[model samples]
Structure formats: C-alpha cells, structure tokens
Target: MSVFAGRYDGRCAIITGGASGLGKLVAARIVAEGGKVVLWDLNPEALAAAKDEVGATRTYALDVSDPAAVAAAAKDSADALGKVDILICSAGITGATVPVQEFPIDSWQRVIDINLNGLFYCNREVVPYLLANGYGRIVNVSSVAGKEGNPNASAYSASKAGVIGFTKSLGKELAGKGVIANALTPATFESPILEQLPQSQVDYMRSKIPMGRLGYVEESAAIIGFMASEECSFTTASTFDTSGGRTTY
Candidate 1:
C-alpha cells in the first residue's frame, strides 16, 4: 500500500527545515519509505520535539543561512547517515510583507540569505557526497509566487524564483553525472507560516488559488517524496507545480 515502493530502502535523506511544517511532513514520509532521515533546523527545541515524535531521526540544530553551519552539518550527515541519497532544501522564512517601496532592506536580505543563499550552501556541500557515490536527487521548494510575483511579498517571491533558477542550473551541470536536481512550486499550503500572516493576507492568498483552499502539507510532501525517489529518474532542472491552477508558467 506504500506508494514509495521500497525505493528508499537503505538510503539517507536530509531535509532542511525538517523541524516543522512541510519539511516535517516530508521527513516523516521519507522514513515511511524506509529511508533514514537527518533533520536540520535552526531551533533546538523544535528539533528535539521532532526527534521525539519521529523516533530514529538524526537532527542538527543550525541556521540554514550560515554556510559554515550548513557545511558542517553536511559532513556530519554523511558520516552519520552514510552519504545522502536525497536532499530537500526546505528552510525558508516568510519575511515582513509590505509594498516594494516600503519593504525593509534588512528583511529582504534576511529572506534572501536563507531561501536563496542557504539553498546554495546545501547544494554545494551535499552534491559532493552524491557525486562521490554516483547518485542523488534534490527537490528545492519554491512557491507559486515565484512563477507570478505576488503583491506585497517581494522578498519571498524573489528568493524562491532564485531557487528555481539555481535548481535548473545545477540539474544541467550534473545531468550526465547521475545527480538529479529539480524544484517544486506549491501554492499557499496549510502551515505554521500561514498562522504567522495576517488573516486578511491569508484570505487574499487563498482566494487567488484556483483550488479555493490552501494546500495540505502532506500533499506537498508526497509530491516532493516522488521527486526524491529513484523512480523519478527522468526529470531534472524541471519545475513541478502544485499550484492549484494558480500557475500558468
């Protein structure tokens, strides 16, 4: 009954932001599929709670935006999990929302550092492990806003768009090397991040989605799971949109 089909047996997966929300769901799914999971998060308490709930999970408490921390975690993960077969760059922040003219420079930089630069850190460090082992799959979580920039969310939108571009470039570079790099774009999903937004903004976002409802974290996780699986062998530098009809690009 498992759609994972034992494709992940004996493999190791690293998911940044795995302490909560979509990342948490993805990590749980990876374990369900017989893969070992190493969760990287900025919050120590959340990581501890997640490990308690998930059981048998390796966790690293570190900020994704810190390249040194990311690199160290990558080395530790390789040593602990035996070379990552899958890497999901899910660490992101929904920064201060305001019109472009009023957007704070610091906030914009914060979002970019984590969503864009942090993603690069993971790819840089993890890919070597994959390349050395001759195989790997990566799914960077982008957003519907990345495809069509949303009003008042310049920072998040821009950072995610960069992630999409980064994924494509990496996928092509390692195309013949057995490493598959792809990005997933999902419409507003039900998550703790939504709880952080003003209700008005939340309703505004939901209305734009053709589905008329926020996506479930588990649904996004399943799609990402497939992309990380060996069965997803044909796609690279591709964007798999889970936009609920909110995407045209």
Candidate 2:
C-alpha cells in the first residue's frame, strides 16, 4: 500500500456527481493519495459542502446534460487543474419508478438526458485533453440494473446500459492511445439517491443480491481509485461489477 499510495501524486481528476455518494468518496480517495480533484455537480450547495468534506481543488456547479455547459466546465476544469488525468462520470439520477406502460414520458426523457446523454457530453468534452496529453483514465458509473434490466426502472436501466455500450466504443477508439475507458456496474449502494426509489422496489433489488446487503460507497471508491490509477493498465472497454455476487459475468 505504501508503494502504491502516491500513484496519483501530481495527477488531477474530474469527478461528476462529486457532491455526494460514491463520486464524493472517490474524490476523497484521490485527494488522500495526493491527487488534485475538481468536483462537478448540479447542486451548488452540495458542491460547496463536498469541497470542504473532500478538500477538492475546485468545484463546478454545472449540468452535464447540457453539452454547452459540459464543454465550458471541461475547459474550466482543465484550466484550473492544469491537466485532468482521470474522469469519473458518476453524475446520474434514478428517475421515477413505474412500469413502462405507465411511465411518465417526461420522466423517461429526463433519465435518458441525465444518465446517458449527459455521460456522452462529459466524455466528449474531456477526451480531447486526454488525446493531447496521450494519457488518461475514464470510469463511467453504470449499474446492475442495466445488466439485468430491473422491472419498473426502464429509464434507469436503459440509460445505464447505454453507458456500458458507449464506454466500450470509446475505449476501443482510444486503444493504445495512452487512454483507457471502462464502466462499473454496481448493485444498490447506500446513497442519498436511494430515497428516490419506493421501499418495495428497493427491497426487491436487495433480495436479488446474494450478499443480502447494500454496497458501501467506500467500497466503490476503492475500486474506482484503482481504475483511475496507472496500476489499472491493460484493461479497457470492460465492465467491472461491484454487485456483490449478483452478477457473475
């Protein structure tokens, strides 16, 4: 651990949804390991709070769903941090819980906009810098729901699945370019986002997990930290599962 402790020493990272949840924990890990971090989140208040909590180098209150905003924020982050070696796209939302037939059209679109399209926007804006430097790591947060397609969560599942596909394509394109892209498919984690789901739906999800427990944000941060480090070489266009035995593939 001592030898690997400073893996990110001098590296800089951009973490979306860093205001809370796994993203924030990732930021803490990077910072703890001597990396500079720029936190991006839609909530200004949460961003401020997270800055204090994680000792982030900078914080941007920007909506990743908007391409223009994403582009601007990307530039700002690069400028502020000097260079961004890692990008963690954890900014997502779990939209309404309703069957496809009864799902609200607005809710479906919103989930797609934030979870999928927003991810694309961030990746598009950041990859350029990585290309110029010829070095980078990208970790997109997906979910087990995407792989298994949870009932009554069509929007969430579909959006996360899109992330998995998009990440694979991006990784292949960057193959041998000193950049690696991958996605993480995690089971239900203890986070504020869980409040959006109905208790019944949450229970159903937990029942499927052989571990009989929700994932901890710290556990996810640890995996993500490794993925963002130079130690994670030779892996790209892959999906790493944090599903507690729920997904064997």
Candidate 3:
C-alpha cells in the first residue's frame, strides 16, 4: 500500500505534463519520497499551480513537441537539478474522437506530434544526461488503446502504440548500460484528461475493464513509482499493465 513512500530518495526526475492529471500525481508521489523533481509543462498557470502543489525542485514551461524547446529545457533542467536520473514522458493530448476517415488531418497530426513525437523529444534530449550519470529510469505512459485499438479513436491508439515501440527500442539500446526504459499501458483513470473525451467514448472504454470501474491516480502513480526506482531493476523495454485486467497479453 505504500510502495511510493520514500521509494525515490536521492533520485531526480523530469515529468512532462506535470502540471496536471497523472503527471502531477506522480510528481507528488516522488516528492513525498524525498526525490527531487523538475516539472515541464506547457501551461504557465498549471505549471505554477503544480510547482506550488507538488513542491518540485524546479519548473519549466516546455512544449515537448518542439525538439528545440525540449533540448533547451533539458539543458536548463539538468543545470538546475545537477543530474537527470528519471524521466516520465507524460505530456499528451487525446485529439478529436472520430473515425479515421472523419478524423481531421490536423487533429491527427497534432495527436501524433504531442503524444508520440513529443515523447521522442523528451527521451532523446534527456538520455544524454542519463547516460553521463550511468543511471536512470524512464517511464513512457502508453494506454490500453495502444494494445487494443479503440473504435473512433485512431489517433490516440496509434500514438500510444508508437510509445510502446519507442520504449522497446530505447530499452534495447540502453541495455547493459545503467539506464532502463519501459512503458505503462493504463486503462481509463480518473483524471482531468478524461474531460477531453466524449461521454460515449468514456463509457465504452470503462466498459472494457473487467473490474467495471476506472483506475485511480494513486494506483497509476504506484506502478510508476516502482518503475522509476532501483527496485524495478531487471525490467526494461517492457509494458506494465495498469488496466484493471483489461489487458491479458
């Protein structure tokens, strides 16, 4: 029940989308465990709010989809924290909920940009610092939709699937080196991100869960905390399911 408490002592983490939702929850957990955290979020207001709420060591207004921005922020964050030990690529958007044909081209591009490409940017920019330190825990947040494509939500599913593939390659590339990479496939959880979806889509997703209920922020954060810790040794380039039994694979 207390997997996260004091689990991250001495570690430093960078959490994208740390201004709200699961990202914020994970930052809070890491801080509670005495870990140092630097938050990267696009929303200035939410970034300020999260800094106050989570007590992160530093906060940067970052747009992860922008490679240059991510690279610069990575340098600034490392300069501020002295080292980058963990990375949680949590910033993303769901885009529009429409079928492939009806999904606006712009919407699809935006989804891919923020969810998949943005994740790439963060990982690429931060890995150097991790490699220099020779120790790191990287957690990329995917979703059940990545495993099982959802109806009328092609962009989200594709972006998340890309995350899984990217994490796998990263894990392999960093294997034998002190850093490890993994992805989280979580089912619908109670968070502000839910507001982005339509009620029908939300209900459909929840219905797929065997537990007949959505997951909780703490539950997601627990798995993430473990993944981001030395305790998660031996697991790399793998997907951890927090899908309430919705993912049997």
Better of 1 and 2 by TM-score: 2
* Per-residue C-alpha lDDT of model 3 across residues 39-103, encoded as one tens digit per residue: 99989999998998999988999778899999999999999888999999888889999888899
TM-score of 1: 0.97
Model 2 regions lying over 4 Å from their true place: 1-4
The positional error of residue 101 in candidate 3, measured at the CA in angstroms, is: 0.9
Q: Candidate 2 lDDT, tens digit per residue, 15-124?
A: 99999999998888888888999999999999999999999999999988999999999999999999989999999999989899999999999999999999999999
lDDT of 1 by residue, 1-249 (tens): 235646678889899998999888888777877888999998899999998776535899998888898999999988998777889989999888799999999999999999999999999999999999899999999998888888899999999999999999999999989999999999998888886677887888899988799888877888998899888899999999887889857
Which window of ten consecutive residues has the lowest lDDT sum in model 2?
A: 1-10
TM-score of each: 0.97, 0.98, 0.98
Better of 1 and 3 by TM-score: 3
Give the lDDT of residue 200 in candidate 3: 97
Evaluated against the true structure, the overall lDDT of model 3 is 0.93
lDDT of 3 at 205: 93
